[model samples]
Target chain A: MSVAIVFDREVAERWHLREVGVWMFLGTVVMLFAAFTSAYVVRKSGADWVPVHLPPLLWLNSVVLLASSLTLELGRRPGATARAASTAIAATCGLALLFFAGQVQAWSTLARTGVYLPTNPASSFFYILTGVHGAHLIVAFGFLAYLFVRTVRRTDVAGWPYLAGLVSTVWHFLTAVWIYLLLMLRLA
Target chain B: MSHSDSFIRKYIFSTDHKIIGIQYILTGLAMALVGGTLAGLIRLQLGWPGLQWPLLGKLMPVGMPSGVMTPEFYMALVTMHGTIMVFFFMSFVLVSGFGNYVVPLQIGARDMAFPLLNMLSYWIGLLGAIVILLSFFVQGGAAAAGWTAYPPLSAVASAMPGSALGQTLWLLAMALFIASFTMSGLNIVATVLSLRAPGMSMMRMPLTVWSYFISAIMGLLAFPPLTAAAIMLLFDRHFDTSFFLPSGLIVAGKLLPNHGGSPLLWQHLFWFLGHPEVYVLILPALGIALDMLPVFSRKPVFGYRLSVYCLMIVAVLSMIVWGHHMFVSGMSPFSGEYFSISTMLITVPMTIIGVNMLGSLWGARITLATPMLFALGIIALFGVGGFGGLFLGNATADMQLHDTYFVVGHFHLMIGGVTLLGTFAGIYYWFPKMFGRQMSEALGKAHFWLTFLPFFTVFFMQHFVGLQGAPRRYYAFTTYEYLNRTHGQNVVISLVAFLLMAGQLVFALNFIWSLVAGRASERNPWHATTLEWETSSPPPHGNFVEIPTVHRWAYEYSVAGEALDYTPQTVPARQVAVTA
Candidate 1:
């Protein structure tokens, strides 16, 4: 018998349940950040709202995230050997981690420049949105790490492509959400 | 769920939707007792002020010092009661529990799209319940700033005793609940959307499935804003960021260090989820009633498409009506008018749904089964609750009625009454399916009358006292000279409330007794035409031996020239069968 949670006898053949599930999950992530955006706009309109210049490292991290998505696409290109596919995915995960390290670096850079969380409303929102997005990335990282290890071990390589697609969607979606939050802070 | 799985794997770490569903229902039952005791404490303080029970002092020494319930303690009880009843209890049983057990089976699927996530949702939710309950044992009492947790009081720790550690724990617990609800709701939505059996078109699915589908989607859309609010509130309380706490003059004659913050922003964020959160409970109750109306009335559901449309419309309207709750929060007159008009517009679809049910029951051979009785009761009580909304929906009218017993009364009927009736109806209706035994009809009928009568008296009296200007959230109304008559009504409401609680014992004992020794029933006891009835009394692992193909909509009762009164969705069309 197949897994109780993961498999159905007949329905899985008819539709991409995993893709649909990922799409629905993205809807919620969108709402969560949408709320943060609204709160930012609302709080920014108030007095004592001092906007802080974000650290320059964030631009580099954005490029790193964009690169990670690219390497993910590269890994899935046709005729890639098993070893090559594994190596590409490993590179993508490494870049994703580097991107997070860059985020922490940006926070420290802000702190060194005399901008703390409770220093002002804009600073507070800046810390919050970044912190929340990091928390979600941590969860995504865990899943992606599973995929990385699976490709290395190749125990579930047969189904790893399917799993890889789902995780990739989340990874790319978060990358887009980060860009949205980044731009909202910068422009809005 | 597999036969080869061990007891620990099959039952404890089970990913089976049925087991997870029972976990939700049973946890909700336990929390209901806790919530009910809190209510009893509230009524004791309000009904007969200063009445001391030494046992109470022994039970909770901090909240009730020397048998006297403190004002802060009363506030905590009120907050915890509302929080527990609405979020913990109702959402668990009706929304997650019923949705989990019924959605997969009724839609003719093996299990939820993500059953592992379903299990995770239940466990995380249980953790949240434990965290909230643990707040009572902390240095301060539970959250006192109302379940809404409107900021300034909720944000500032030293505002009250419960405001200290308890409120922080409340936010943490709420964050946990929202996370769990997010996962569970997504699972429900995905299952409904993607996992239906072949030939089970969206319209062919039962209203029970439709209601739950809409409720899950609505919850998924609505909860995140509150998540955003909770995150900020936690920051405000712990980090002193002043997200919801404005620059204040004095707290104990000392100036606070917080800067500019808008408490109204918290209201907007909280109610964005809070308004739909009410519908999250109620729309399912309405759905439960809508589906059952066909079963008991033995008639094709009146306006099946319209009922589904009404649910969809309500879901959309429920999102926008969050502002109606902020009418008295110093909103601009123009914004208030906009919110008010949109809020009233919900009643149009709601009224249509009600009329559809009444029309379904008109001149039909109604069963008057225990489930039917509770289902009918939900319809009547909902009408009363909806009528009260008309008064509160208007900004000018709510100016007098906001925070009054009238507002309290309206919600109690709509949320409290409807959920209570819906829970029982669902339990009775599905008991045979869940446990494979029928509950006692005599006890069920007795339970209905006992609960229904007092439910009417207790809440209905609030509307009267509210009209007379008796405010809510007070420690005791007896202290006010103008509220002297209101105190008398309070006592009556209290006494009847005791009866209403006592009435639930019948259901409890009936549930327990029926589980082991109630009358044995067949697979389809109701003779209903839903897909769930087509399976075994207790459906097995993966729900069906073979995936059943749906042929028609769920409600095909008393057809013009059919051999049977009802036809299961699995049955093929006569024309198709003949051609084959």
Candidate 2:
């Protein structure tokens, strides 16, 4: 029998099964965050809802986040060669760390503006919404950092796709949620 | 060495699915004792107002001083009892216990897709149970807000006495508990989809697996909304967020600083998860009933495809009908109409399922074994519960009956009645398979009859009290003329509840006694043809030593030309032909 058939029938069974489960879990998390963002918008439009000012640092954080996504993508490229791929992975982790620092700075800036979490309902929501999202991002970043370490150590590229796909998808989703929250803060 | 040999490592603390199943059963049994005792106290307090029962009075010194139940303590008992039984006992016992042990074995898999995660799921769930129980001793006592934990009442510390640290712990425990369930759901779905042996097609797979698979999918989709709701409520309490608290709200004549949040928002998120949660609790029992009815009837389940289709329909419809719970919440009029129509539409598929179950029992060799009796009881109780839905499905009727004991009766019959009865059926049916010993038929039948009579007596009367304007979740009612009329009925119901609580001891005694003392059984004592029956009793760690290649569907009993009534799945196609 051909190698493809042999592998497909034998080794692929357990691997494919695991992939389906992991993807389903990742998809569920994505949907959960998506629904929360939608609820945030709907609730933001209610009467007496006060809007908080968006921090400028968020724009810088967004850029760092988008760049991290791109770097992670580049690291996954087939023809990029090993050294370049490892460098891209390390850079992605660095930018992710910067993104986290930027978020903390943004919170500090908002606090200085007298927008403490317990000051007003608007401020309280701003902290909770972003804080929860940031906490999730921190978790995702930890997973990505682990992947980066493994990539630098020359772990098999085959396993990378699952984690890589999940991390990128979640990163993109977080970015989209931030944009939605930003618009709601500024306009709605 | 014989495959039946076992070491301590192979039994207790074992990663083996069978052992894990026994662990859940034993733990659930222990929790049931606490739950049952609480139920007895609740009934005693309700049966004779101000009656000083010694032990119960001593347990709740502040709430039931000399056995006079304070409303707070009564609420606490009801709240904890409901929470413990539904989450810890029913969900764990019916789904995690039975589903974990049987799903893989019946589908011909060695173990779950992720055995390590599977074990962790059980441990995390156990940890969650401990956390929840610990809330009883917390500063403010256990969470006394109704299990739904409606906002403002549940959000503000001044709202209720128990809305303080205890409620916070309850929220944390629930969040952790959902995480554990999510892990288990992922495992069940993955194992069912990917691990069936070579010839066991999805169609050939047993109904229990299908129900569990669908229930897992429901849990995956439904639980996160509740988690989100719980987190928002926590923020409202601890961090002064107004997510569920409206502006200009006055609590206890103190102008609450919280503003601009809609309480309806919390309801929307909660019911979104709550309605599907009913199915998550009931579907496994329904699956158990489906599996047992066929075996006892000695026939393939009537309309197997239709039954599966009904389960899918119910799962999807469950998501939409959540809005019905919001009917009285003063949501938008349009939303009420949408929820009302969707809620009624669920009955279409539910009817189909009921008909298929009744049809499965028609014109068959009905063996009135203990499991079969409970299975029949599930059909009857589920029918009563389902029929009662008509009163609540209509917006007009719901306006009258919402939050009434009628709704309580409806749910009790559906969930507590059908689900618990079906769980008993499963426990008795699978006892032999799991322990390699047969439970006492005499004790089983006596327990079933005692449980069946009291169950109906308690809940059947509840519907009337509900119709007569008796609100649920009320610890004590002021003596109005109409309310006084229903007091007699309440007394009767409480008496029956006491009996129902006592009847469970028979099950407990039977279970423990049978584990060590009952007669050992042959591998396939039930003479069933399911894949699980083909394996050795208390199956090996990897389940079947040689994977079974199915020649036919699980139910092939009494087929033409077969010498034996049943045909095990592992039997070769040629042997089937030869027997024919």
Across residues B401-497, which tens digit of lDDT does each residue of candidate 1 receive?
A: 9989999999999999999899989999998999899999999999999999899889999999999999989888876789898877888889989
Q: What is model 2's DockQ versus the real complex?
A: 0.52
RMSD of each: 3.1, 3.1
lDDT per residue (tens digit) for residues A37-90 in model 1: 888888898889988898878999999998998887666555566677788889
The share of true interface contacts that also appear in candidate 1 amounts to 0.75
lDDT of 2 at A165: 57
In order, what lDDT does every prediction score?
0.88, 0.81
